[model samples]
Target chain A: MKANIIIRLKKNILDPQGKAVHHALSDMQFGDVEEVRIGRFVEMVFNHNNREQAEEETRKICDKLLANPIMEVYDYTIED
Target chain B: MKTAVIIFPGSNCDHDIYYAFKKVLGAQTDFIWHKESNLSSYDLVVLPGGFSYGDYLRSGAIARFSPVMKEVVKHAEKGGYVVGICNGFQILTESHLLPGALHKNVHRKFVCRDVYLRVENNRSVFTGLCREREVLSIPIAHGDGNYYCDEDTLRELEENAQILFRYSNEKGETDRRFNPNGSVANIAGVINKSGNVLGMMPHPERRVESLLKHDDGLKILKSLVNGISGN
Candidate 1:
């Protein structure tokens, strides 16, 4: 099975790298971009017998490693 | 005193600290590779600065899971003295041995320069030789050295006097101007709740000798040695 994990900085966290990209987009004339916060997208393929087990394992991995709870919020979806 | 300087694959400051401990501090120091699982015999364990694991997936994320880190965790839990400098500091936080997380600099740049730090609380073993309000000049080189934590943790740190260092001017003014990376409360270093582990984003080992025109780092290292050796 495969899963897509989306990791984003918490709303209150300051993301300098994300702000930098927003500025660059303005310079490129992208226009009217209110804000941009960059984050990580992880794709994982592992051995799991079923979707429930895969999702449970994915959540555990996110909590343990893929996302730092101090600065990020994460969620994932499994795909066939 | 016996000290172990942890050598992660990309660690570049292992020798600098080893030299400082051996030549300057006159302590027996060895470089412990990251794969080594035994950290029980050392009096002090140091995580030196560098791009460990090429700093992939955030600064210290990948390196924190190294085989040796488990033992390091055990060592810290046992109240063993451990100090993490620069990238080492990042690892300490990533491993949950320290309270806060190191984010990218507000300026979004990699900074490399000597910065002044006010010894905030000298009661801890790491700063025992440093006088409160004493300012030490130490070099910090990192892109993700900005420290952040929740308000509750900050309040607890202050109440417990766990803060060890704060970026400041020579006069020890801790306003935002002195904060290089915009860390919360200008914190440059902090001790664990038990006060045994220390993490800071400064390179004290780089300036341990008078030949470098600064022996301030020596003062800190000496404190570490003396703290562990009870000298």
Candidate 2:
């Protein structure tokens, strides 16, 4: 099975990197950009027998290591 | 007092911390590798600053799971003193030993300079020797030192007096302009609820010698030693 994870800072959290990129885009005349938020994307391949088991394990991975609950949120999809 | 400085891979400040404890402070100290899990015999365990795991996933994200961190957690749970500095502070947060997280600097650039820290709570095991609100000049070098936490957690920390230091001016005014990293509440350091763990971004180890222009860092180190030695 393969798990694709997207981790991002919480909506209320201030992302300085994203702000900088937004500024750069505006400077380049792409002023339609309303906002930019930088985040992490991770793909993992592991052995799993069923979709349910893969989802559970992926949740565990996100909760334990991939995303910090203090300031970030994570979502994932599993495919086999 | 005996001290152990836990050294994770890519930790550049390990020797400096060891020297601060062993040579400058005259306390017996040893370097414990990240893979070694036993920390039962040390009075103080220090996590020094540096790019642990090269700041791979996130600052201190991967290093928190090192075999030695389990023992570090055990040590702290037993009321043993644990101080995490710079990147070490990030690890402490990632390990959930301390509340909140460290975000990138507000300017999105690595900040390295001397900054003034106001002693917010001198009653801690980490800051007992300092006068309340005393301004100490310390050097901070890190890109991800901006501290963040939810409002409820911030309220709890404030109510419990867990805040140890805040970035401030020479006169000890915690104005926004003095905040080097945009940390919430200008927090430069904080202690856990149990008061046994301390996580701070400033490098007290880097400024311990008077010959280097300031020994304000000694006040913090000496306080820890004194608090532990029953002095």
Candidate 3:
């Protein structure tokens, strides 16, 4: 199975790097730039037969190794 | 006293903190790697500052997930003393071990200079040796030291007296310009709700020698020694 995780800064937390990028986009003449918040993308390959098990494992990864709950939010999708 | 300095892969200040504990404070200090899961023997566990994991996503972001941090969280939960400095502060925030988050400096620059701090509350174990409102000069080097939390959290922090230090001038005035990263209310350091964990952006280890200053950082360490000895 292949899993793709998308992690982002929690809402209400200031995203300075994203804000800087938003400014740069405006400087480059990109019109209608509403907002930009950077996030992490992690792709992992796991051999699993059960969807529930994969999700449980992924949550552990987020809590224990991948995403920081204090500053990030993550969601993962699996493809077989 | 037996102390341990948690060493993340890119930690640059672990040796500095260790030297401060060993030579200045005359404590037996050990450098624990980030992968270690044991922390039961040390009286003090220090998360020294550096660009852990190259600070790739965010300062201390990747390091928050290090193997040793799991032990750190457990240690803090048990009322063990933990101090996170600079990147260590960022890690504590990233790990949810402390309230608030660090954003980039409002000026968008990596500031590196000595900054003055007002010891806000000396009742905690970390600042027990310092007088209330005493001013100490310490160096800060970081891009994401601006701390932010909601109004309610800030109110609780103040009400609980969890605030440990604030950025200030030599005369002890809260000068905005002296606030290197535009931290909220000029907060430089804070203890956790339980008062067992202290996270701060300033590098106290850098000021532990008389050659550096009057070794004001020594006083803080002494306070920890006193706390461990149950004095």
Candidate 4:
């Protein structure tokens, strides 16, 4: 099984890197952009063949190490 | 007093802290590797600043899982003194030994310079020698030092007087103009609820010597020495 995870800062949290890129884009004549938020993507391979077990383990990994509950949220999908 | 400075891979400030405690303060100190698990004999355990694990996967994220961190947690839970400076502060937050998290600087730039810090709570073992509201000049060097926490956690920290230091002007005014990293409430340092663990972004170890033209950092180390001796 393989798990693909995407992590993002909470909606209310400020994303300074995204903001800087937004400003850079505006300066380059791309003025239509309203906002930009940055996030992280992670890919992991699990040896388990059970879809249910892989999903459960992926959730645990996200909660424990992949995403910080203080400022980030994460979601993932599992496929074999 | 005895001190142990834990050295994670890529920790560049470990020697500075060791010198501050051993050579400057005349306290016995040792460098503990990240894989060592026993910290039962030290009076103080320090986590120094640096780009640990290359600051990959977020600052302090990877270093928090080092084999020694389990013992660090056990040490703090037993009321042992622990101080996390800069990157060390990030590790404490990742380990959940301290509340809140450190985000990237608001300007998305690495900031390095001297900043004034107002001692918010002098009653902590980490600041017992300092006068309340006294402004100290310390150096902070990092890209991610902005501190953030939920409103409820902020309220609890305030109500419990857990805040140890706040960015401020030379006169001790905590205005937004003096906030170097956009930390919430201008918080530069905080103590855990039990008052045993301290996490701060500023590098007191870097400012401890008069050769550096600033000895303000000595007060923090001296206070810890006094606290341990008095205990």
Candidate 5:
């Protein structure tokens, strides 16, 4: 099974990197940029024979390693 | 005092901390490699500042899993003193030994300069020698020192008096610009709930000498020594 994990900073937290990108777009004369938020995209392949079990295990992985609970929120989807 | 400085592969400030202990406090210092698992004999273990593991992926992320940290955690649980500085602070947070996490600087730049830090708490083992609210000049150099924690955790820290240091102006007033990083509450350092483990963004080892000008860093180290020696 393959899993795709999307992790991003919580909305309440400031996204300085994204803000910097917003500024750079305006500076480069591309004024159409309205918003940009930076986030992490993680793709993983799991060898579990059961798809449901694989998704559960992947969620554990997300909680333990992929995202820090203090500042980030993550969601994962498994594909067979 | 018997002190050990944990040496990671890319730790550049290990020697600086070692020297500060040896010369300033006349401490018996040992260098423990990151791969070592034993740390029972040391009165204090220091995770010095540096670009540990080249700060790959995230600052101090990889270094937190080193074999030495297992022993460090055990020692801390046993009431042993632990101080993490700069990259060391990152490792402590990564290891879950301390609360919160360090994000990229607010300015998105690596800042390296002397700044004033006010002592928030002087009763802990880390800062017993300093007066409460006194400001001292210390140097900081890091790209990801912006501290972040949830509001509840921040309240817990404040209620428990775990906050140790806060950045301030020369006159000892809290200054947002002097904060350098957008740390919540301008917190520069904090002790663990148990109050034995300390993690701070500023480098006290860098300010232990008169030649460094304003050797106020010694006040904190002296407090540690007094705590260990029961002086």
Candidate 6:
């Protein structure tokens, strides 16, 4: 099974990198943006046929290694 | 005193720190590869700065899981001295050995310049020789050096005097303009509750050599050397 994870900075955490990108887009005449917050996307390949088990394991992985609870929150999905 | 400089794959300042320990401090120093697990032989272990693991995912995010980090944690649990500079600082935070995360600079630029740092807490073993509020000039080179922590941690850091250094003006005032990175409270360095582990974004090794004419970094190294002798 393959799993995809989205890791993002918490709403209160400052996103300087995202702000820079927003500014660049605005300079190029795409000025309709109110704000931008950057986050990370990660993929994982698990050796199992259990969709339920993979999703659970991916959450545990996010807690232990993939996401830093202090700075980020993560959500993931498992695909067949 | 025996010192070990932990050499992660992309660590470029390991040799510079080794030189400070060997030639400057006249201590027996060696490099320990990141794969090694035993860190019991050394009196001091330094995680020198560089783009460890190519700063993948995040700076120090991947390097934190290297085999040696397990030993590093054990070393810290025993109250052993560990200093992480720049990228090494990022790793320490990522490993949860330190209480914060380094985010990108507010300007989103890789800042490489000398900045003034004020010693906020000089009572720790790492800063024993330094005077509180004394400003020192140090070189900081990094893109993601803005330090952030939760509100409770910030309160505790303030109440306990755990903040080791803060970006400051030449006159030793913690002003906004002196903050090269947008770190909360303008923090440049911090020590854990035990005062055994230290992580800072400034490159102290870069200024250790006399030829560099910036000897502020030596004060920090010498303070640690002095602390070991006193202990």
In candidate 4, which residue ranges exceed 4 Å CA deviation? none
For lDDT, candidate 1 versus 6, the one ahead is: 1
For model 3, what is the C-alpha lDDT against the true structure?
A: 0.87
Name model 3 segments beyond 4 Å from true.
Answer: A63-65, B65-67
Q: Tell me the whole-model lDDT of each prediction, alpha carbons only.
A: 0.92, 0.95, 0.87, 0.94, 0.89, 0.90
Better of 1 and 6 by TM-score: 1
lDDT of 1 by residue, B79-145 (tens): 8889999999999999999998998999999999999999988878887898878999999999999
Q: 3 or 5, which is superior by lDDT?
A: 5
- Give the interface-residue alpha carbon RMSD of model 1: 0.7
Estimate the TM-score of every prediction: 0.98, 0.99, 0.87, 0.98, 0.94, 0.97
lDDT of 2 at A59: 95
TM-score of model 1 (first chain only): 0.93
Q: Could you tell me how far off, in angstroms, the CA of residue B167 lies in candidate 3 after the best superposition?
A: 1.7
Q: Write the per-residue lDDT of candidate 3 for residues A4-73, one digit (tens) a residue.
A: 8998888866777788999999999986998999888999888776777777888898776677565578
User: What is the full ranking by DockQ, best candidate first?
Assistant: 2, 4, 1, 6, 5, 3
For model 3 the local lDDT of residue A33 reads 95
Best by DockQ: 2
Error of 4 at A39 (Å): 0.2
In candidate 2, the residue pairs with backbone N, CA or C atoms under 3 Å apart (3 or more residues apart, or in different chains) clash, namely: none
Q: List model 3 lDDT by residue over B1-231, tens digit each.
A: 689999999999999999988887788999999999999998789999998998887788788878898999998999889999999999998888899888778878999988899998999999888998999988899988998777888999999998898999998898787788878889999999999999999998988878866677777878998888787
The second chain of candidate 3 has a TM-score of: 0.97
Instruction: Please provide, for model 5 over A1-80, each residue's C-alpha lDDT reduced to its tens digit, 9 standing for 90 to 100.
Output: 89999999889888889999999999999899898789889999977668888888888887877777878899888888
Record all residue pairs in model 3 with backbone atoms less than 3 Å apart, i.e. clashing. Answer: none
Spell out the clash pairs found in candidate 4.
none
Give the alpha carbon lDDT tens digit for every residue of A1-80 in model 1.
89999999999989998899999999999889989999999999977658888898999999888888999999888997
lDDT of 6 by residue, B60-99 (tens): 9899999999999998889889999999899999998999
